[model samples]
Target: MEALTLYQLNRRIAELVTNSSTQNVWVTAELSDVAVRGGHCYMELLQKDPDTGATVAKARAAIWANVFSRLRSDFYIATGQDFATGLKVMVRASVSMHPVYGMSLVINAVNPEYTMGDLLRRRKEMLARLKAEGILDMNRSLCWNEPPLRIAIVSAEGAAGYGDFMNQLNGNQLGLRFTTRLFPAIMQGERTAQSV
Candidate 1:
């Protein structure tokens, strides 16, 4: 029988992981938690069991400051979404292990299309769920207001479309008096839902 110190055991595991994996591989996982500190993006990635909804695997990952800055902008441009919690992402990363930190993935690139497709699929699934629950169109039976006089506008401040809509409504030749109120909201990115 032989005894191994904690450091010796951890070091052996680290060496095994580093040696067994490819230098850079593409992986898909859901972002369970994400944060930025000191310009670096740190994340918790996980995979859940489809049938039971239990997390089956999890890992820590990071994008260095230099890569984060560029990747963040490129991802947003490609997907029209921020790298936020709950996002399913496909990333190119290298598996690495540190004796103290255990195992982590060092992310270098992202496949925005995968996230965009996931979002679309999720939206469709949500709509289907709502329909099955018999609430998808709960307001469809509401009476329509003919010549609707009251307008409630939810839009970003200084939006050209809002201004144009107001101009057309207020400057109508019929001179129909209408009551209108503007409810400003953030129109894009992660905070859009909360703002609305």
Candidate 2:
């Protein structure tokens, strides 16, 4: 048996990866982590087992500054969202291996439609589940008493919408008095769910 140093083995792997047919392949993966540094986007891509919800495959990936600058804005324009953790993305990438960094994918392009489609699918699934549980129409089924004099507003303070709502309610032509309370809440971004 012959022995090889760690660098020699890594070099061989790098060569194999570079020459492989996987170059310029399209892959669908979930972004477990995303970051931008020095204008380059770095990400960790993964796949999970549908039934168990456990990660089954994972890889490191990156988009160089030149490509990332355009792709980032394009993706945001198409998807109405930024590249963030937990987003499923379809990307065109080349598999690369380095002696020090092991393996990573060099992404050159991204398909924003893939993420949008996935979001729609997930929303549909959630709605279906709520329907099955008989909660989907719960709000519609509720009966209002006396046209609801008390308004509980959930919105961020100083928001334009909040001001508009208050103005509309206060300027009502009927001159009816109503009690209103503002419950400040975050309306968008990552912490919105928890904050709201």
Which number leads on lDDT? 2
lDDT of 2 by residue, 1-196 (tens): 9999999999998887786588889999988657789999998988988899688998999999999999988997898767776778899999988888899999999999999999899889999999999999998988977667889999878655688789999899988788999999866434568877
TM-score of each: 0.67, 0.68
lDDT of 1 by residue, 105-191 (tens): 999999999999998998999999999999999878678777789889998666556777899999999999889999998654345
After superposition, the stretches of candidate 2 with alpha carbons farther than 4 Å from their true spots are 134-196
> Which lDDT value does model 2 have at 29?
90
For candidate 1, give the lDDT.
Answer: 0.86
Kindly report which residue stretches of model 1 are placed more than 4 angstroms away from their true locations once superposed. 1-3, 131-196
